[model samples]
Target: MSKLENIRIEGIFIKEEGRKATLKFDMPFYADSQPVKWADSGYNSISLEIDIFDIHYLEIKT
Candidate 1:
């Protein structure tokens, strides 16, 4: 059996690679006490890239 950890991410759907999907979101992001921030804000939004393999399942509402 595998241990499952919960992860929550809020972002906008961007695009996908071969095995990854990119998301657009806000910064001041943190995980496991680690933090990330952008020094500059040239673009209107931030992008987050996540692996599809990390996702067990998802629900889409449209």
Candidate 2:
């Protein structure tokens, strides 16, 4: 499994029928420490979507 750090969330979508949720991110990178710079030439331009199904519970703390 790949570990992604400091994920910047771009969008969120939810499906009420299936109790599913999707998280969208742009150019996510795996780093041991520190956040990656967006302007870095080494970074790849990629889009990521994570889906969660049958979520039993969720809490949002801001």
lDDT winner: 2
Would you list the clashing residue pairs of candidate 2? Answer: none
lDDT of 1 by residue, 1-62 (tens): 95323323465452343334555334443344333343243333434544454454556543
TM-score against native, each model: 0.23, 0.55
Q: State the lDDT at 37 in candidate 2.
A: 70
Checking candidate 1 for backbone clashes, the offending pairs are: none
Q: Give candidate 1's TM-score.
A: 0.23
By TM-score, the best candidate is 2
lDDT values for all models: 0.43, 0.71
Judge candidate 1 at residue 29 and give its lDDT.
Answer: 33
> Measured by C-alpha RMSD in angstroms, how accurate is candidate 1?
8.0
Q: Please state the error at residue 10 of candidate 1 in Å.
A: 9.7
